[model samples]
Target: MSNKIKEREIQIERLQNNLSPIRKIAGWTAEVLGDKIGVTKQTISNLENKKTPMNFTQYIAIRSVLDYEISNNKENEVLPKVVALLLDCDDELDEADYSKVQDVVGTVAATAAGGTSTDKLDTVFDVLIKTLPFVVPIIGTIIGTSANWSKKLFK
Candidate 1:
């Protein structure tokens, strides 16, 4: 590829990388975001994972849809806020807890989508319960919150 073409590809890859965490934090799946952006899930996946070339128009559309979703549903920002507070806590967290955070997100989402795995649900709650000392205070610090937020959510 020419130098200019290579530079453009780099820019596209950078844009896709930046958008991914925002999409996850906003609770959007590829299919859902693709639908909102007038593209297919494969297209979004290609852009995010395979460094597929995207033009300016596609970039704008993807960004606009994500921006709209985040602006309209500020509640979706809770996970990141809680995570930031967890990282700030004086107590040390087990290295395993970091990996379990991903599991908790996936398992909880699956449960919400009617997944029938009771065992997985139990595991998710177990991770949450383990993290309660770090999470509960941050949640309580947030207004309109209560300690009951952590109690047996899966039960």
Candidate 2:
């Protein structure tokens, strides 16, 4: 087999490993993600187990669903913890902090409503910058910012 093929296989294995935890973090069972991806539960399990390789289309579909859940807080079934944290100190918030919070909330809301466009890399960057004070680093890692989905978005 070609070295490029072998490297691609390794990358897919790594992606499968990473995807399992992200799916769990998003509160999605294999069955749930499978439904979203139009695949069977067994197929989802196989992918998660790294017993099967995911095609580019499957990766994109799964990433889209995960991104929606993260931005919308659907996984937690509540407002983002960052919002609650900001709210808890609302009385003491300075103008700057308040403005930052508002911007973050607006960005998240907009993204939830499908406000982001691939053509607008600036919008994505804006959202990322606004979310920096929150748990976005961890979230980004889980969702694989270096993955093809983000590369496509930034491209």
Candidate 3:
């Protein structure tokens, strides 16, 4: 209500948002974290702002609740639900979707340039390896160096 209180609330919200897994793992801020732990929204706010620490027992209780929920709903539930939204969206992927597939160009073009039919299909596979990072957005950077091998050989 007071200006200081409002500022703290905003800062707390930002802190929660900045957490990498707060959205992915917790399904957003102050969610089941509060409902299951018997902690109030205000208490969660204070935790996020570092005004107070999460008691060891409270952390155990809260984490157990979230872990149970996320683990039970992990792949079959969460992945499918997320995929459903992308699949059901009204906007169909345009040429932009192919952009993720762009790393294919050099390999395919090289194959074409070489004018070789022997192992020509390897281009598709090679390109797929190269394009895989861009295609798999989840851990793109992890596989980033993997693609560089192709650039070394090709270019």
Please name the candidate that would achieve the greatest TM-score relative to the true structure: 2
- Backbone clash pairs for candidate 3 read none
Q: Compute the lDDT for candidate 3.
A: 0.40
Model 1 steric clash pairs: none
TM-score of each: 0.43, 0.45, 0.34
Q: What local lDDT does model 2 show for residue 71?
A: 70
TM-score of 2: 0.45
Residue-level error in angstroms, candidate 2, position 11: 6.2
Q: All candidates: CA RMSD in angstroms?
A: 11.7, 13.8, 18.7
Off by over 4 Å in 2: 1-13, 74-148, 152-154
Full-model lDDT for every candidate: 0.50, 0.51, 0.40
Q: What lDDT is reached at residue 94 by model 1?
A: 55
Q: What would the per-residue lDDT of candidate 1 be over residues 37-111, giving only the tens digit for each residue?
A: 899989988876756876767755764564455357554544333333222222334546634544554445555
Q: Residue-wise lDDT of candidate 3 within 11-40, one digit each (tens)?
A: 334333322223232343465457777877
For model 3, the stretches where C-alpha displacement exceeds 4 angstroms are: 1-20, 76-155
Tell me how candidate 2 scores on lDDT: 0.51
Model 3 lDDT-worst window of ten: 81-90
Please provide the root mean square deviation of candidate 3 (C-alpha atoms, Å). 18.7
Clashes of 3: 0
Clash totals in order: 0, 0, 0
